[model samples]
Target: MESVSKIRLWILQEGRSIRSVARATGLSRNTIKKYLKDDNPPSYQRQAPPARHKLCDGFDTRLQELFEQDQKRPRRERRTAVRLYEQLVSEGYTGSYSPVQRFVRDLKRTDAGSGEAFIPLHFAAGDALQFDWSEERVVLGGVEQKVKVAHFRLCHSRKPFVVAYPGESQEMVLDAFVRALSFYGGVPRRVIIDNPKTMVTYVSRSKDRVFHPRFLALMNHYVMEPVACTPASGWEKGQVENQVQFLRGRLFVPMPAFDDLDGLNDWLRLPCEELANRAHPEYSARTIAEVFEDERAELRPLGRAFDGYVEKTVRVRSTCLVQYASNRYSVPSRFAGQHVSLRAYAGRIVLVSGQDVIAEHKRRFTRNVSYFEPWHYVPLLDRKPGALRNGAPFVDWQLPDGSLSSAMPR
Candidate 1:
């Protein structure tokens, strides 16, 4: 690997004889003589550095700023990475996706560590139990309906509970949590969850999650901390996620049909409780119940029963009845034309006008024409008798003479 200049100087100054050059340079005699007349250098100088691309010129700072902004806002309007990418593109960023994706990936990795800042509980010592719902299908009265299965698994015991309900609304979600807490005989210090709109209203980029006010109020009532998982990492709540599939197969595979939600819920509870008490299939000495017993002491005792509150707003109609899920409910005549909040319980509907109980009725199971009492709808008939023509009270308004003109002007 001698320099070309050095080789040439050696050849010119030390006598260009091939044998003499080879002896002086320590190169093979034939090699030294061949290079003495050759004109070009070796061809190994073409290696170069990789190309540079900027997917996010200033996104790290922007992402940090966005996360800070989200802290003061509701979860429903938080900025997502996908949303941020669109924003970046609009700002005339000329970078390709790889860089953007890479930056986001790193950002999320850091956020994951920050988001998991939970006070770890000891195994078998009442560690935080998390509850959630995953979409499932079950047959109700011979019809297959889409539903969300309520799922709860003790972090320490890994003892899981599941119940299927018709929808993912707030009432159903909260109902499931109450039942799970009751079955466990206590509430964990913290209940972890994924961001369902029912519970979490927003997620901050700092990984702070904003819970719905009513939901947070429920947590406060139960004396348990509510921890929400990072939005995209479904794996953060993997125990319940795994139990969802397990329960789906073990409980719902045969697709048991039932008369109603109560019947189905009643039936689903037994086997799940049995499964929890039974010895672990793989672990000989431990049962789910055994592990959960240890977790119970770490949990906070239930405060006042949730009162099974299902908060909903309904406007009073002209008929003095509030429409709820395609069904009509009667309020007192005094509440007509005013907006009211309805608290639907298992057996009653409590209509509250700003902390004042305006009206309450036994909740009706049937969807069509459910009435609280004769008096509730009597005012409607009194105001407009014709309104009862297609109502449940239509026959009650008939005159003994079998004439429609009994009370009409003759």
Candidate 2:
């Protein structure tokens, strides 16, 4: 192109003769004349592709069909290139696996959704919040375990709050909201979440969700709308989804060690606060904390927490205890033969009968261990004086002063 441009400029613009242009440019007059006649620049032509082998005759079409079918199935159930190759071999295709593998790879790269672009999302202050759960490994009480960390991010301010729970149960989801809302000092107009069974019971064909009743109740109490993301759409809550990775690197890395979940949570709080001191991701001039203050003012004022609990009705056994989750918890001795509502919260279990709370015990996560309140058996002692000798609840009971000897059977 450079030579052609110079030649044309010398002849057409500068009025140089074709013979002089060819002589000066070290090209034959014939080549220079051809260059002048053709208006388009010279371009290289690619070699024609070699013909495909006989075995690939119907293989490309079959591969396309298999890939299209896999796209409709669940991601985990999708066939790999090797699996597709195996299926093709079973069907009597004599071609090597390389061609089949290449075709699948090419199809994936050119799929309709693969090459598409997404519009950048913008949020008004207090407009929405994104919630997600992440699994992080930490040392707690000398044991290395994975903790479920609930992450909450305000869409506008990008301020984040996280709390670790033993597991991601329905009650833990509620408790996380309580903690996050308290940290932000207000509630956003709507919350965006994934379609987890804990939050969403059903997602209709049109994306309408039948949110879990208790979860819906909490939203109703706060006058907030709950938004469920499409089944596999992590981009809907992309802020929190990204936060989970960012925070795992920033906070959980180096493996923080704490004696209890509370201590770990307390340690997590300082980092979260310090993060706000950094420059905001979008508005670099202002710190996240500064922007958070502005967004906080736009937020709805924080109200009383929802009394979130998973309630179950169970009949107390003969031993003055009720069972939940394969474990026994003592209710009041009087309710041993009666039915009571067991309200399970994130941290405690409360047994309620009618308007009365008969017994409350710290919730336990372990299995098969019975939790007992020694005082619940005091009334039974009067009728069964010999009970203290062999009762499981009294085994570790600490009697006051000399009361053990005085109360013993004489």
Candidate 3:
């Protein structure tokens, strides 16, 4: 393509006729004449598409496989084009990503059939906080257990909090959130969470979000808005991404050690807080604490305390104990004959009698036995001494198997 200026120069300075300029430049004779008369130039292309790949082969098969994998896996777990290309190269593919990615993306369009393109978003300060969990195995005193850490992040400050917990239950999530709030000194105006059953009930009819009752209650108490991120977009809440790495590298490195979580948490609280206060190298001019203060002031104060947590209705087995989690909890002997609602929290359980709690016990964990007012098991102990020994591993029956003593049960 020739510029209008070049054509006009040829016509005026070089004395080329309009018809001749048109043949040379591939413009209409009239167009060439007009440009020469007006001295106006048309835009010319500066560049063309880059050269095509000569090395790439089997492009169709590769694209089909990539698209099939993307369809099979959740978006969060799907292999990115870069990763796919890397894997392909390892498997004797010499192709670069441009054509392969272009083809793979096109395949997505067909597979989607909805014409909706995946769009990137910009997050604003105080707008959203993303939540997720990561598991870390820590060996403390030769005992190794895989610990799940609840992670939270503030999008604006990029500040994050993480705490180790046993499971991803509602109670653990609530405790983690409260601690995170305290760590950040405020909550984001809106929290963007994944579809963890702890907070989300069912996917809404409109494919919106349905939050669990307890989760909804916490949101109401805090007066902050709740926003559930799309089902598979983990990057939606990426503030915790850096934090998860930071925590695992800094705190969990060389492996963490503690006799119990309570002791570990006590040691962990201060160091984590200090990490939050430390100045970020990227934004060395200000600390996360400084940025967080602004967000903290904007958050609404928490209202009424959360109604104590409890698991769903569980039955008392033939052994006359209500089973919560894997550990068996006992109510009073009188209530043993009847079913009861077992209210459980992070550290405690209460057996509710009507509106009142008839009995409460500090919740016991795995391989541990808990007994309430031991009189409840006297009849069973008398009936079967061997069963009593098996049932109460941590207790002493104070009687031989052949003889039933009238000793008071401790």
C-alpha TM-scores of all predictions:
0.61, 0.72, 0.61
Poorest lDDT segment (10 consecutive residues) of candidate 1: 115-124
Candidate 3 on 119-181: residue-level lDDT in tens?
555656576777778777676546987778887777766666667777777787887777777
Model 1: CA > 4 A from native: 1-124, 281-283, 310-313, 345-348, 353-358, 361-373, 380-410
lDDT of each: 0.71, 0.87, 0.69
For candidate 1, write residues 195-314 as lDDT tens digits: 888899988879788888878877888888898887777677777776776666466644668876778888878887688877764466989777667667777776667765777788
How would you order the candidates by lDDT, starting with the best?
2, 1, 3
Mark the 10 consecutive residues where model 3 has the least summed lDDT: 401-410
TM-score, prediction 3: 0.61
Cα displacement (angstroms), candidate 2, residue 300, comes to 0.7
Clashes of each: 4, 0, 0
Clashing pairs in 3: none
RMSD (Cα, Å) for all candidates, in order, is 17.1, 11.5, 9.7
Number of clashing pairs, model 2? 0
